[model samples]
Target chain A: MDDETRALIDALVADARESPADLARQTGLSAEEVEARLADLEESGVLRGYSAVVDWDRTDETGVEAVLEVNVELDRETAYDDVARRIAESPLVDTMRLVSGDYDFEVYVRAGSMGAVSRFVSEEVAPLPAVTSTVTHFAMETYKERGVLFDDGDDDDRLSVTP
Target chain B: MSDETGSEAADRSDGTAPPDPADSVEGSDQSDPAEASDPTGEGETTAGDRFTAADRVARVPPSGIRAFFEVAEAHDDVVSLGVGEPDFSAPWPARSAAVASLERGRTSYTANRGTAELRRAIAGRVERYGHAYDPDEEVLVTTGASEAVDLAFRAFVDPGDTVALPTPTYVSYEPGVTFAGGDPLAVPTYHEDDWALTPEALAEAGADEAEMLVLCYPNNPTGATMSADELDAVAAFCVDNDLLVVSDEIYAALTYDGDHESVATRPGMRERTVVINGFSKAYAMTGLRLGYALAPPGAIEAMTTVHQYGMLSAPTTAQHAAVAAIERCDDEVARMRREYDRRRRYLTARLRELGLAVAEPSGAFYAFPRVTDVAPDGDDEAFATDLLDEVGVAAVPGSAFGSGGAGHLRLSYATGMGELKEATRRLERYLDGR
Candidate 1:
């Protein structure tokens, strides 16, 4: 396997309660190398702890995801982080990044409905000094779901089984 | 594949000046036509060993497409529209004339500017289309329009000069431009405009820092031709902006509908425009490797200088054949042109009937239709690749041309009518699944 695939194996063993062999079987890696690599990673504090990958989609929280492309006010003297924090403090804001070109930032904000999103934009998002014009695009139906990339037989088999 | 070793540059680069076209060995022998077809082996070397092994050699990892062609070639029952060349033999008169030249042993090198007789013939031919040229000073015979294009780039463009070209163009233009150390500026020609190069777009292209602008009429891939007014506008734009125009009119004589006009024929445009023409299309002599360019005297001299250093001249015997062919404008060329025109008409109608948005092809032997017009999100390359893979048809993907060709497919109707019908049938079946 390539270098990226090796690192992925070590990360899997440290984070989730999966054995090196299981990870190997899941990612098409050699079981022996996976075990040895994981041992070395743990000794270096690289393998930290096991955590669960919770099904956020099935959770009680009903949040709608939308993309917000922000064009910064050219006259404003405020820095990027100033606007970032204002949006980040709201629990609805999931991700934000400073970007190039016509837009200064891309904000991924999760709220309830269109009305609720409008409310957040007007009250919480618009009032900020560093704020600029925002264009919103709603999420359409997903044709392919994104998840952990696994190609080995075991991962395919495990995915086939429903909880 | 052969053990014959020349200068590393000769093997790796195509920029070196070639040998004299008048070399006897480069001519056709009536006894062996294949011998005449050999590309001249002299002046084939370069001075510097600059590139690494990887840079010099092309790695031929298995090509599924080539493999398919190999398999297809073995079958006698297989009717193929896969190949993109005329199925007819070189017109008998042209062949006979070529044989006569070989028999006469007029196999010596001609002037770098080409023979007086052949140049006069080319001049006469161009004059018929309203483009006046001095055969002695303006024209230089080369090895097909392909070589003329390569020479155009090398002679006119400096290291950073951008050569603007409309996309959905011939595949060779980009590589040739790059080989000349120039950048290829691809302007997207969409199906919405029926693939016409708009005046606004042409103006912008000329306004760009590009030193050269290329236009192919009876265009390849799209089979679209610019109208007389369009040609005039383009010529005016190029003249205004001082961009050298390279008009490839190889398929000029094959226009199906009406008269074929050259941009060089426009008022005051001949000086700036390089008219590239060849026998490959009209005479159905693809294997002959013969073509010519009519440029301004200075451009002709520059191209000859480059040709001398890199490629000395076009094949000698082919030049003689060309002289004979041009001298006698027989019914053979006219007959072939009529046949191609018939094929062009039939193919476009059939494609439109199939529900593909085929732009009415006024010229050339190609029919480029938008694939997504029938199948949405239909990747043209995948569609073409899969078609060849499953059903065994070998049309090129329009994407191979440029970005403007994203959802299009280029089908050549140069083959026999029977093969064309079979290809259309297969296409119909393929689209039926969609």
Candidate 2:
């Protein structure tokens, strides 16, 4: 991608809600060009979707999240793929990725409560044939998400008038 | 010639003002802070035949909005559009470079022209706006563009030589020329012309009498700018009249319309122009105080001589920081310029809706809106005061800029949307009450 295309992506990543016209003005691209590129990016699946970085503590939702490290001993190479596909389909799992680290998979799980998360791990995850050991770390609060910091308390501290 | 130049420079050095006692009283509304500190009035001994400020420095009145600043500061909820500054922090890489230099213990004074690294960066950076300065002899890193302006005047202007400054310009230009013992000639440009200085306006103001011209665009106080065609006319006028141009392009990156073209790029103009720029407004590095001047070899050498005496060099940390800023902050500047443009559009449109005539500012982050309809008796001072008192919104009165800026108010939009929206809402409420 060229610099302008990269800039357009960077801008959207920062604030997806910014208008096309404003994005164009920021990136030195015309609004029409921005529109054309957006469509192209979307069609090619390079630009997947836009979502808010929600501060759940401020919202009325009751959800708990945790990081789960699952150690699975695969009997065969095909067993790893079968286990990964099965875990990805679970409702409690937000994201699951295969890794080269100590753990076989680092899974992000979100459920209604800690009780629900514990139940998902005990009943759903460890029951797999290749699963060897499981470790779950509960997240207490989120200070940041999606590359954005929350409530930094920064304000306009400059004097009202200056030269 | 060397003796003559040396003697005059010495005269200026010796004539530098002793701290004026009256200077501290500039912004007091009722109570003097000095009186409280010295109750016995022992400070009165200063009046008896003692030397005062040099005539030129004393002639220009001090600038203040202190009374207003105090009043606005007292209010916890006041929404201010008064300061000309960016809302962003200095680019992280720039700040990190400063930290890295500090870690390396690079705090010693640098060469008077600044570190060769920063001078080279400045030479490269000015290329964006078409100024081709040689790093060795044609560039001087200054404490800030304020010092660069002063250096330009001292380097070129003889005592009593006139310098043409377009009115409704930044606060520093007029006084800087005077401080250098040059007469400031105020040339006017009106909103009818969108505040761009034409040859006609220059000629009408007796600009031929001046030996130097100061140009700032995207201008402060008034967000006026020069198109290439407009700058061509001004360049022709300067060339015909044998004038040196001190072009302050500090706000060059914030031009909303098109890319800024340095006047030095004009035909036969590079030899006679000094292009001044800084990292303050563009890079949001105001506190770092890094600025540069690009000029001909002789002029830069002369300015460097002045800088060597007053300020030996720009800070080493700041020079290093500016190198990082110059090399890496174009994307950040583009991002900021985009944000400022949005605010410019919103603020100007909102002001027009409130029954004011704001000439759509072409550059900078200010909108100079004529406040005749909303102000009492078209008095912007009273209007500004009443707005802050009644609605808790603070804006600078247009009259403070110059006579041409009378009946208007300069509202800087280099603030966040929340503040701009709040300030304008209070502005509308204040107008309704009036």
Candidate 3:
């Protein structure tokens, strides 16, 4: 049962929208097995969620994306989790991680504009009680997002036919 | 694809690096054998000319894949299941290491046997396959697995010695043997046996006369894989006959069901086997052209002798990248293998539903479907040509891979599942119209 669950998760990791039939074939489990296993995963929250990988720049509304490194001076009660929870309340935070080395937390900020991003960092984030120092490294380009290359440089370079 | 045949890169695709006559792809009907057999009209010779291709060079026939390439080249929207390489890119670390090698100015030639690090890596990689080779003496890295095959036959086989090649395998093996001055004895391995060479079949094919046996499995064109028990039988036969074995395990890591057993691991087989493997199929580094030969010291020395005098060494950047591939990219290899396995299952099931007899492929990316149901009288070539013209989908005729492969179409599952689904739809439509 756990084997099927792992296979399902692996297949889902490759293509979130993969049909149950393809998932079944890929994982070597029956369609019913896939359905049951997926339901189990969702029920247990082992499968977190499925979402689309979007490049906001390509869409109508352009956004500035940046990595905000927050080094917080935490008290005995204000743990890393508390800091993450407070910072994550802002909608600008796309992803938050309590990363080690050089920073206490790494927050990915994606906003409609550079001014919005700066405003969110200054007004909402920097003023936090535990926040000691913060560094903003704005991304000029998003070359890859969620493992998908933004460009077609990985085109097939092989000859039309080879043995 | 048809537009740029003059480049040096295109020539490397050919087994012997023959000049591509694909510029004629504009008008010539490649379906005609007479025209295709002499693609460049180089067969027309003049007595006064100073340069004539030697009998060894002229004797090797044009690969059956050439016509299919030309047919595919003529079309714009071809969803080809005819490719033999992996669709995945090289693992990120390997790609980055290649870039780093250039950035670090390691652009000069490597050792004739390859760099110490890469040779050690090759030794370690082959060690996982259950054979231990001395990195300094037993591993000889070549331009690609294709080159290692040529060097193996050339190093061991004499002018008239025969090399037994199983039918319906990689197209390069036969020509490669011939080019090395060895007569290739075609031992037909039937689809009934999953395209594997059995002891009885070997004896019937008079393999006892051959000095060496050539193998590729999980195979190309057929995707047949043999169990360790089956390999033990063949390995015993090789021992009894005292024949050398050149086993190409390029598709070894891509085996879908069960483990891929190397013939070298069999008793009495290690000393006689020259193990050829590469990053092309498994690591998706075909463009890098990195492969290695693991053999006994004597065989490696001979192959290196031929390699140094002719090809010298493999690309330095490629060697460094290969080390990184061996050390850091196993997860990437597994991911690619899983993807191919998924596509393989999808293609095989869909083709079977379409009323074609598909031997469930247990290895490699190909699904060899017998086309006698649609292609009456087993004329796969004509059937394939019609399939291309009737629909825009392209596939290689099984006859292209040699005997025991006739009456079938070798459809590759190397592309994306979406593309396979679309190709299968077109195939279903073609079948329905039939």
Cα lDDT tens digits for candidate 2, B352-416: 76888888797878889888777888799988888888988888887766677788888988787
Per-model RMSD to reference: 27.7, 6.7, 4.2
RMSD of 1: 27.7
Alpha-carbon runs more than 4 Å astray in model 3:
A1-7, A62-66, A113-119, A133-139, A152-154, B1-50
Candidate 1 lDDT, A33-144, residue by residue in tens: 7677767777888666555533345578766677788766644566777777677788877678888887888887777887778888878777666666878876653333
TM-score of decoy 3: 0.89
Off by over 4 Å in 1: A1-163, B1-79, B203-207, B374-376
DockQ values of all predictions: 0.00, 0.29, 0.37
Tens-digit lDDT track for model 2 on A33-56? 999999999999999999888787
TM per candidate, chain B: 0.83, 0.90, 0.91
lDDT of 3 by residue, A1-163 (tens): 4545666777687679999987887777788988988898899988889988887777887778899999998788998899899999888898999887988889999888889988998998889999998999999988888877898553765555555
Better of 2 and 3 by TM-score: 3
**Who is ahead in DockQ, 1 or 3?**
3
The parts of candidate 2 lying over 4 Å away from their true place are A1-63, A67-108, A112-115, A118-141, A146-148, B1-51
The residue pairs found clashing in candidate 1 are: B16-B310, B17-B309, B17-B310, B17-B311, B18-B310, B18-B311, B18-B312, B21-B316, B144-B291
